[model samples]
Target: MTETLQSLALSIIELATFIFVFIFLAAIVWLIWAYISDIRQKKQAIRRNFPVIGRFRYFFEHLGEFFRQYFFAMDREELPFNRADRSWVYRSAKNVDNTVAFGSTRNISAAGEILFLNCPFPTLEADAVPPSAITFGEGQARQPYTTSSFFNISGMSYGAISKPAVQALSQGAAKAGIWMNTGEGGLSPFHLEGGADIVFQIGTAKYGVRDDQGQLSESRLRSVAAHEAVKMFEIKLSQGAKPGKGGILPAAKVTQEIADIRGIPVGHASISPNGHPEIKSVDDLLNMVHRVREITGKPTGFKFVLGAYGFLETMLKSIHERGLEFAPDFITIDSADGGTGAAPQSLIDYVGLPIKESLPLVVDKLIEYGLRDRIKVICSGKLITPASVAWALCTGADAIVSARGFMFSLGCIQALQCNKNTCPTGITTHDPDLQNGLDPTNKAERVAQYAQKMVHEVGVIAHSCGVREPRELRRYHAHIVGDNSFSTSLELLFPTRSVKPEYDKRK
Candidate 1:
């Protein structure tokens, strides 16, 4: 027995030694190959100079973004959205208690900080009323749209986000009684599945409503308008993220379904024209609007990011010359800092006006031109939080829309992989394995909760300001922090311009 045991132990030891030797040889072979490859590579200077050792730099650099988000960054320090803002959205979506234990981490005295003026005698709960319903294209379109939802889900194309993400947003928007914009990708069946009011966007590409030659097809326009849920049509002159550019869907994301819906070829990168080819001048724009409204019998509007002020004045003047009936039902002003699936870094960072400067400018211009009552102003660009929504109402926006805000409700971690096909949370990716992480039914509930809570919190702000409802909020109800760390009334900074008496008389 002793002799047999010794022989077995020796055999086991020999097996272990052989395995280790094989692994060591394999490691050496891999290292030698990698070293040779790195030395020969001309694309990366660090790899060429340092060989295998420099490869770690790229790996470490990729890891740094994750490390900074989880550890090094402060609650209020992150860009696009800070940890505090994301945390609030998460809690709100989860329908959990979102109250902070101690003081706020926000820099209250920072320039551009918004401060609401609380009334000594705030509006009592007994006196507070729900937001009044605002109707679009009243007495004009055969089927006008009227909704009281103050905060709504903005345009996020089906192709830009995953199938489940669109499903969840549509379901949630229905439950929350808010409208969903079917972005520029066009209307898919998922958009209709939830029974929510839909706003079909007409991109420069013309997408779902385009003919075989990529021109606007009247038959397709009639078909889309035929859907009862499609409440309005928005002509996307330009999105905020790429003001002078167009929508870009990578070939990898352009699956058959998305391609069919967008009227583009499968597995091809879908890039829209920079601007509407047919609609060149302001007159052409109004003509297009009239054409769409006549065909669809729905509220028709155009969305654009503000840059040159002269065109706006020309557009408004032309509206007067033509008729109020020729004017757009709404004007959607997109902010410079808006989010998108893909855009050039230069356009995203430096091209257009941020919401802070642009919203008030557009609102005041509308009032000055006596079109404030005629044209409903819907502003979008990072107005995710309740305070920001309230500020927009005060600044004269009839409604506020958010895209990334809803994405957070759908469990986006801001991995910044939107342009890529590897979104970790499955909100922006088309990968079936990644998309499995998102259950449309479950995430839909979270979406509803986020929208409901946002509207509730904005109401809280409105009540605190002694207003009966959100729309009652005026510019004087809020203050903006100045460079001196002192605050000035928003009403003073952007003084309310009087409507021209001639146009006011027409109203």
Candidate 2:
């Protein structure tokens, strides 16, 4: 028995040695093959020189992008939106304590930094009145619209975002008492599912209410208006993302459902015309607005980014000649740096005036022409934060609309995959697996929280400015960093129009 046990141990040791030798020889052969392949490959010099070690460099570099964002980037370092900006939105949406301890982490020395001038005796919360409801298209429009919320959802199409995203926004808007603008892609079933006040958008393409020839279809317009949820119509001239350009939907993203809604062919590039073929001048635009409002019995407006001030001057002058009643109910001045699903790098980077500049410019012009009461100015660019919304109010914007902020509420990580169909958060993508991860019902609550928080905080800013309400906040309430490295009051820079209206005093 002792001899048999010894033999068993010896046999086990021998088998182990044999396996080790086999693995050693296989590894050596594989290394030799890799070395030869790397040396022969001329495409990569580092791989040729360092063999396997060089591969790790690329691996580490690939990981650095995420690492930088999560670990290395300071709160205010990132562009477009920094870590602090996104975190605020996330916390607000989750209804968490968003107040930061210690002082602000903002770089006040930075150019273009905005500062609010608080009154010594701020308005007490109890005495401050809430934002009052403002009516649009009052006398001219057969069915004018009214809403009190200053912050609202901007244009984001059902196709650009997902079905679940649209459903969530619609329900969230209804709960938050704000309106939702159905982007230029056209109205879809999800838009009306939540019984929310809807603003139907008419792109240059004429989309949902278009005939086979792409002309405005009175029948389709009437049908969409028939729904009690649809409240107003917006004629989109040019969005901020791509000025002098048109909306673009890649062939791959053109699902049959979206195509049907937009009256385009499936599996085809869904590109809108640069400008409406029928709109040769400002008169043509007014005519179109009148036609839509007449058919739908609703207030109608046009959205555009500010370009040549001369044209705006001409348009306003023309409106004056045509009568103030001919003016659009509202004008949406989109920021040049506005976000979009897809656009040429040239346009997205440097083609239009940002909201910071455009908002005041448009407002000043409207007030200059004495058309401020006739036309409401809805500013839509990057007015995401409470301070930003307050800034809009102080700078004379009647309403604020935000798209990216609401997207964040729906769990978007700014993956920048919106133009593609691989959005992992399920906010922008249509893939079944991704869509399953996003719960519309759960996200809807988050959306409502974000909107309500914005309303509340903006009111806080207005009260701090010693205003009775948000609309009362004026240019004197804010300051902009000047080129001379000093904070200059906006009232001094973009001073009140020489011919001020009596209402300005009350504000």
Candidate 3:
């Protein structure tokens, strides 16, 4: 019996030894193959130089972003959006208590920092009223738009974001009683599904409203305007991210549905013209605006990023030469740091004016021209937080819009994969498997919560400033920090312009 037990143990030991030997041999073979492959590969210099050991560099590089976000980044240190900002949005979207425990981590004395002036006698909660409704194209268009929503969803094309993301935004916009810009991709059925007010954007390519030859089609324009949900039309002269460039959709993301909606060929990279081919001069822009408003009977406006201030003066002077009726219904000024799906590094970083300088410039120019009352100023570009929104109102923006804020509400991780088709959160990708992570019904609720929270918080700021509503906030109600570690009133920095006597008389 002792001999039999000893023999059984030896057999088991032999089997374990054989298995270990097999695995070691397989691993050695794999290492040799990898070493040869890395040495022979001409693509990567590190891999070719260091052979097998260099393969770890790519793996480490891929994992570095995650590590930094989770471990190394301070609350207020990240660019585009810091951890604190994203955390606030996440909490707001979840409809949880967003109140911070301790002191703010923000650098209050930093240059360009905006601080709201609190009044000794703040407005009582009962006295505070909702933002008054603002009318667009009041005597200019047959069907003018009037809405009380000052905070709105900005231009995010259906092709740039996933279908579920669009659906969620639309649904959320409706619930929050705000308008949704259909971006430059054109109006898809998904845009109409949530029953929200829509602003159809006309890109330089004239995508949805283009004819077979890629020219503006009056018939298509009429058809798009025929929808009751489409409240306005915005001619996108240039966006902030790539001021001199155009929209770019990767071929991989250009599915049949998106292609059909955008009036482009399927599986082809959709690149818009750098600028409107037909609308060359400022006169041509006004002409196009007049034609669109005439055909659609809806308010029409043009969006652009400010660069050369001289062109604006020229355009306003020409507006006076022509009739006031020829002027655009509204003007959307975008900031330089605006986000986009794709853009070249040079244009995205170096071109255009930031919203800090541009918003006040445009607003003062409008007031100077005596067109402030006629042209509603809607500003966008990183005005995601309540404080930023309040600052815009204080700086004279009639309304504010945000795109990345809504994307965050839809669960974007800022993975920087927007130009690629592999967005981890499914907000910007077309992959069905990735999109399955996003449920429109659920994210729609989050979207609504985020919008509602933003509006509510902005109201809180307004009340603190002793204003009855957000729109009542004036430039004097906020202060901007200067380089000398001192703060100056926004009113002093960008003083309100007095209207020219002749233009004021016309008004």
Q: Assess every candidate by TM-score.
A: 0.96, 0.89, 0.95
lDDT of residue 295 for candidate 3? 96
Ranking by lDDT: 1, 3, 2
Q: Give the candidate order by descending TM-score.
A: 1, 3, 2
Report the Cα lDDT for candidate 3: 0.93
- What is the lDDT of every predicted structure here? 0.94, 0.87, 0.93
Q: Give the Å error, residue 186, model 3.
A: 1.0
Write one digit per residue (lDDT tens) for candidate 2, span 84-140: 988989998999998989899997767788899998999997898978999988998
lDDT of 3 by residue, 21-105 (tens): 9999999999999999999989999999999899999999999988888899999888788889988899999999999867889
Best of the candidates, TM-score: 1
Candidate 1 segments whose C-alpha is farther than 4 A from its true place: 1-23
Candidate 3, TM-score vs. the true structure? 0.95
Of candidates 2 and 1, the better by TM-score: 1
Comparing 1 and 3 by TM-score, which wins?
1
